[model samples]
Target: MSNTPSPTPLAPRRTVVAIAAILALGALAAVLILRSGTPGGSGAEAAHGHGHSEAAGHADGEHHGAAASAHAHDEAHADGEHHEGGGAPAARKSEAGHDEDEGLIAMDAQRMETAGIRLAEAGPATVRSVLQLPGEIRFNEDRTAHVVPRVAGVAESVAANLGQNVKKGQLLAVLSSAAVSEQRSELLAAQKRLSLARTTYAREKQLWEEKVSAEQDYLQARQALGEAEIAVSNAQQKLAATGASAGGAGGLNRFELRAPFDGVVVEKHLAVGEAVQDTTQVFTISDLRSVWAEMRVAAPDLPAVRVGEKATVRATAFDSSATGEVAYVGALIGQDTRTAPARITLPNPDGVWRPGLFVNVELTASSRQAALAVATSAIQRMEGQQAVVFVPVQGGFRARPVRVGRSDAKATEVLEGLQPGQPYVAEGSFVLKAELGKASAEHTH
Candidate 1:
C-alpha cells in the first residue's frame, strides 16, 4: 500500500544524473554547431578574439610611434635652422652664430659702420725692423773748449755771458795781470836795447870798412847786436805765451780770453773785478750746432752696430727724428752696465737738440721688402697661436690667421695667410678682436 500510494516515489528518480546528461548534451550540441560554423569553429573564434586584442595593441603602438617620429622630425628641422648642417657654421651664419664656439665677429653693414669696424686692403710694402736703444744727447766734445787766463790776473770785465753764442776770436772775458805787465815791460825794454844795438852795429861796420876802428871793436859790436836781438825775441815769446800783445801803448796788464771757435759760452767762472789765477778756467765754450747721441749697445747688437752705419736718432722730449750714421762703436764692454758704447752724430742747427736730452736711437737692425704688410696696430692675438687680422667680408669682417715676417713701429710684414690688395681692418682692429672674444666666451658657456 505505501509503494503504490507514494507512487513511484518519483520512480527513485536519477534527477541529478538526468540534469548532468542534459547539460552534457547541450554542450556537445554547442560544440558541434561551433565546428560547423567556421573551418576551425571554436579555435577560429578564439583566434578571432585574440586577433582583435592584438590589432588594438598594434594600433596603439603605431599611434605612439608616429607621434614620436613627428616630434623627432620637428627637432631635426629646428636644429638644421640653427646651424648649416650641425657641423661647421656657414660664413653668413655668423650673425646668429655669434654665440657659437667659432672665432667669428658678426655685424651687418650698418652695424659695422656704427661700430667703427673699418677694413683696408693689404698690399706689398717694406718693413723696417727698428731696434730702439736708449740714448742721450751729449755735447760735442770735439768742438768744446775751456778758455783760461794764462797768467794770474784780476778780471776787469766779462764780455760774454753764459749761453751767449760767439764766433771764433770773440772776446769772452777781460783781465788785468801784473805778470802780463812785467812781460810787456821786458819786451819793450828789449826792443829799445835792440834798436840801440842795431845803430851801434851799423856805425861800427862803417868804421871797420874805412879801417878807422879796429876789427875787434867791429866784432864786439856785432856780438852785442846779436845778443840784443836774441833778448828781444825771448821777451816777445814770453808775452805771446801769456796771450798778451807786446806793443800796447796804454795799460800793458790788459788781457783778454777769446773764443777759439764758433760756440756758446756754457760756463763763466769769472765775473767783473774778480781775481783769477793762471790755472783758473774763466770760460767754457761749446759749439751747439752738432750734438752726439750716445747710446748703450748690447752685446747681441755689436755686430750690427759698426762705424758709419746708417741710423736714426729721435728726441724723446718732442716729436723730432733725424737720420744719421753711426759714428763709433766701442770695442770694450762696460764693466758695470754690460754694454758697449756707441755714438751717432746728429745735426742740431736749430739748437733744438740740447745736451743731456733723452733720445731714442732707432737703429736699423734689419730691413726687407715684403709682398704684403699691415699696420702694427692691426695685428691681434688669436687663439694664442697665430696673429689675426680682420678682413672685409660681404656684410662685415672676418678674422684670418696670418704669419708675421718683420715688424716696425708703424707697419708689420705679413709673410703668409694674407694676399696683396686684400682689404683688412687697419686702424681699429683691436675693437673687433674684443668683440670676437666676448662672443667666444658666450658660446663656450
Candidate 2:
C-alpha cells in the first residue's frame, strides 16, 4: 500500500452525491408522467383546437361534440388545476353543457315516452281544503245530568250501577232524612186546622141563610176558612219539594233519588247505606244520543276553522265515521300549546262516540280550484329549504327545484316551477333523492 493513509477510503462524499442525483432524475420523470395524464397535456390541447375548428365550420356538430368533450375533460381534470383559473373554467363549461342537454325543454320530450311517469293535464282540480285537528270525544253537555239527593241522609239503597242505562224518573237511590219527617208533621197540622175551619164555615153559612146571624160574622168565618186553606196548600208544596208524599201519610222522610234524564250511568260515587251529604252526586248520567268531539286547532289555523263548518270525526275504536258541524270555537288560545279549542257535535244514536276517547277530526274548509296538483311523493325535500323533483329527459333525469303550495298527506299543490301536462317522477322520487344525497356526500368528501 502506498503512503497517505490508502487514499482515505476514496472519500464517501462522492457516493452520496451520485445517489442524490439519481433520486432527482426519478422525481422529474414522475412529474412528467403525471402532467401528461392531465387535460392540460398536448393531446388535450390539440383536441381543444380541433373542437374550435369544428365549431366554426358546423355549428350543430360542434355543439354536441363540445358538450361531450367538455364533460370528459371535466372528469379527467377533476384533480388537476393546470387548466384556466385552476379548474373553474372546466367546471363551469361542464355544468353549462349538461344544463343545455337536460333542461326543461328536453325533459318534456322524454316525459312523453317514459312509461314509469304518469302525466295528468294540469286543469282545474277541486281541492277540498281541510283543517286537521287533534280532538277527543266528550259527552253532550246538554243531555247529561247528575242525580243527587235533595235531602241530606244516608243512602239506604242504590239501584243504578256504572254503565247501566236508566230512564227519566227512574229511582237511583233512597235516603232517610229527619228534616223530611219534620216537614210532614207541619203538613199534617195544617190539614187538621183546615178541616176545623171548613166545618165552622159551613155552620156559619147556614145561620146567615136563615137570617139568624149577622153578615159580618158569617164573612169572618168564611175568611178564616180561606186562610186555613191557603196554609194547607203551602205545606203541601213544601212536603213535595223535600221529595216526600204529602197528606200526613208515612214515608215522607224516605227520599227517592230519581234520574232527571234518560241516559246511561257513567259514574256512581255512592254505595248502598253510604253516608251522603246534600251536595253529594250519586250517579252521573250521560245521554249517548248526541256526542261532542273536542279538538285543538293551532292559533294560525284558527281562522280557517269556523263554527257550522262540516267536520268528520273518526275514532280508532270504531270503523265508522261521524259527520257533524263545528259547534264552537274557543275565543282564547291555550297558553302552553298555543292552540284554540274547537267542538264538533255528532249524533251518536248507537253510543259509538264515547266520552274520553281519542278521535281524529277533519274540518272541511272552503273548496278551491287548483290548477296543478301532484302526489306528495313527487316532491323531494332538498337541503331543508329547497324542494326538488325529477323530470324524465331524453338521456337521463333532470332535477328541478319547485315552489310548493298547500299539501295534504296524499297530494301537493304546485304553486310555481311546473307547467300543465308535464310529466314528473312520482313513485320513484326516493331513488332520485338518494342520488342527490350521494352526490352531495361525494362533493363533501
Candidate 3:
C-alpha cells in the first residue's frame, strides 16, 4: 500500500460508498420527518422512495421496500376506512337535516283565513264534566192516552185513521152496542112514567089544598111521583156513564169514542165492523208537541242524575239536538243492566223527535275551573298518540302534546303542555295535521 501522501483509489471508492449510504439514510430520515409533519405526505414520499430504491444498494432497496409496503398497507386501510365510514357521517348529516325540518307547518294569515283556520288563546275556563249516556226518544207518558170503549160494541165506523191529527172531543170512532141501547131505552120509559106521575101529583096536591081528596091519597100520589123522578134520573146517568148519547141520528145504540185532547193518533186497533170488548185499546193518541228522551243511568252515575238537572239530548241518527231537564229518575235499578231509567222531557214543537230514535244524553256531572283550557275543536290526534294542539310560534304553529282532563261540548280542559294565554288553533286543526303529514312524506322520499 502507498504511504498517506500517495494517491489512494480504493479509499476513494470506499469513501464514495459511505457517502451513498449516508445519503440514503438521510433521504429515509427526511421522508419519515415529512410524513410525521404532514400526515397526507406519505403518498408522494412513497412514490419518490419507490424510484430511488432501484438506484440504491440491495440493503437500502430492501429497507425502502419494507417501508413502502408498510406505507401502502397504512394508506389502503385509511382509504378503506374513509370510504366506508365516510358514508356514515354523510348519512348522519342528512338525517340530522331532515329531523330539524319535521313537524313544521308554515301558514300565513291569509292562508289561514281562506282555510277557515281560526286561532284562539288558551285560557282559564269552566270545563263541564259531561256524562254521556245512550238513550232513546219516546212518547211522553204524561201526554199519551190509550182510548177504549166503555162498553162492548161493534164498530159502526172508524172516522179516525192512524197518524191522524185530531182536536179535543173530535169523533174517533162510532160503535153500536146493545148495552148502551138498553140504558137509553130505560131512560125513555122512565121519563114517560114520570110525566104521568107529575100530572097526578099536581092534581093530588091541588085537591088536598081544596080538601077535595083524602090526605093519605095525596101523600101516596106525591111519593109515587118522587120515586118516578129518581128512576128517570138514574137512567140518564147510566147512559151518560157509558159515553153514549141518549139519542142519535144513527140509533140509540150508537156510542161515540172521542179524543180526550188535541193529539195525533199513533195507533189504531179498531176498524169498521170490528167487535171490541169494553177493555180493548181502540186507539193510542199522544200530544207530540213534547217528547221524552229516556236513558239508562248506571248505578254509579245515579247520584249525578237528578229529577231537574239540565241535559243535552243529541240524536244519534241525525244532527238534531235539544236541551231538556231530567224530568224523572227511577228509584230502583234494573237487575240485568245494573242501571236506573231516567227521563228528559223535551219540547218537540216541530215533531222531529219521533219515538224510537236513538240519542245521546249529555249531562253535566260537575263543573271545574281549569287554569288552561281550549276549544275542543283545537285538539288533534297525531299518529294515534296523545292529543296535540297547534300552538302559534314565531313563524307558524307547532304541535304540542297535551294531557287532557275534563271536556264538554264546547271546551276541553288542558292538564299539561299548554300555557295560559298561548294562542292555539281553535278551529281547522285537522288542516294543519294533513299538511304535516304531507311534509313528512315528502322528506322520507
Candidate 4:
C-alpha cells in the first residue's frame, strides 16, 4: 500500500512465470506418474493443494508406488506360474511317448511271429493193419551145409576161402588119409582076384558043358570062382562108400572134399597142412539166394500171422527191402520172450539178406473197412481213461473226446466222437495244448 507504486506489470510477469514453472513441473510430474503407472483421481489433486497436504500427497505417492510395485511383482509371479504350468503338459506328453516306445520294444523281443500251425479234416481212410515184430534173417537150413570130414586125415590143401561161392561137387579141400589108402588097396586086390576068377569060371563052364573033364574038378573050379567073386564085390562096395574112384592110382591116399550144395562158404575151419578129424566141420556153406526171416510174434498177435501170410522185412544197414511169405509158425511159444516163432522165406537175389541180421518185420494181420481214420499225431492223451482231439472253431479249438479203435504206428481208426470231413488239428496241436496247460496252471497257482 505505501510506496508500492503501481507494481502491477512486474507482478503480472512474476505470476505468469510462477504459473509457467508450476505448469511445467505439473507436466513433468504427469509424465513421471504415467511412467510409474499411477492411477489418476480427484483425491490426488486435493492432497497436493496445501503445505500440510503436500506431506500427505507425498505419502499418498509413496503408497501408490508401493502398491504398483506389489502389483508388478504379482504379475511376474503369475507369468512364471503360467510358464511352469504350460511346460507340465509337454513333459507329461514326452513321458507318455517314452512309455509307448518301451511297450513297442517289449512286444518285438518275444519273437512270436515264426510259429506255425496246421489243421486237418477227419475223414474216412484206409487204415492198414500193421503188426510190428522183431526179426532176424537166417540161413535156410535146408539150403545150407556143413562140410565134415568122413574120415580122419591130414588136410593137404584148402581150395575154398571164407565167403567164397561154390557150386555143387566143387572141390573145397584136399585131404591125405591112411584109412583111405588101406581101403583103396583092398579094393584093388579084390578087383585083381575077381578078374582071374572070371577067366577060370569061363573055362570051367565050357568044360562042364562039353563034358571034357571030371565033374568034381569042374565043380571045384566053379566054387573057387564064386568065393573070389563074392570077396571082390564086398571090397568094391567098401571102397565106393569111401568116395574113392574105381581105378585112380590104386591104393592112393589123397581124398577130394567136395561141396555138398551150391552156396557161399560162410565159414572155413580147415587150412593147408592142418590135421582134420572125421567129426570136424571143415567148411560151412549157405545158399544166399534165399534166406529165412525169423520173426518173434507176440501171443496176442499170433492169430494174425500164419503160414503163407505175406510179410515185409526191413533192416537198418540196407536200404533195400525183402518180400516173403510165412514159411512156418511155431506151435509152441518161446519160454523167454513169450512169443511165437514165425519164419518167412525171403527172396535174397542180391544176397543182401544175410544171416544174423537184425530186422524189423511188418506182417499184414487182417484187412477191414474203416469209415474214419486220422494220423496218430492228431490224437493226444487226455484224462486217465481216454483221449481227445481239438477241432477248429470260430476263434479257438474245441476239445473233443474220442473213442479210438485199432491203432498202428502211423494211423488210428476213429471209433467215435468224430465225423467224416470234419476239420481238426493234425499238426502243431501242442500249441493249443500248451495254451490250455498254461491256463490250467495259472488257475491252479
Q: What stretches of model 3 exceed 4 Å from their correct place?
A: 1-100
lDDT for 46 (candidate 3): 65
TM-score quality measure for candidate 2? 0.59
lDDT of 1 by residue, 359-428 (tens): 9888777778877888888999877667988887655567898889888987888988888888888877
Error of 4 at 123 (Å): 5.7
Pick the winner on TM-score between candidates 2 and 3.
Answer: 3
Residue pairs clashing, model 3: none
Candidate RMSDs in Å, in order, are 14.7, 15.7, 6.5, 18.3
Model 1 / residue 231 / CA error / Å: 2.4
Q: What do the candidate models score in CA lDDT, each in turn? A: 0.79, 0.74, 0.85, 0.74
TM-score per candidate:
0.68, 0.59, 0.79, 0.59
Q: Candidate 1 lDDT (Cα, whole model)?
A: 0.79
Model 2, residue 359: displacement in angstroms?
A: 3.1
Best by TM-score: 3
lDDT of 4 by residue, 129-212 (tens): 888788888999878888887888998888999988899999888888887888778877877887887788788778878998
Deviation (Å) of 29 in candidate 3: 17
- Show the colliding residue pairs in model 2: none
The top-ranked prediction according to lDDT is 3
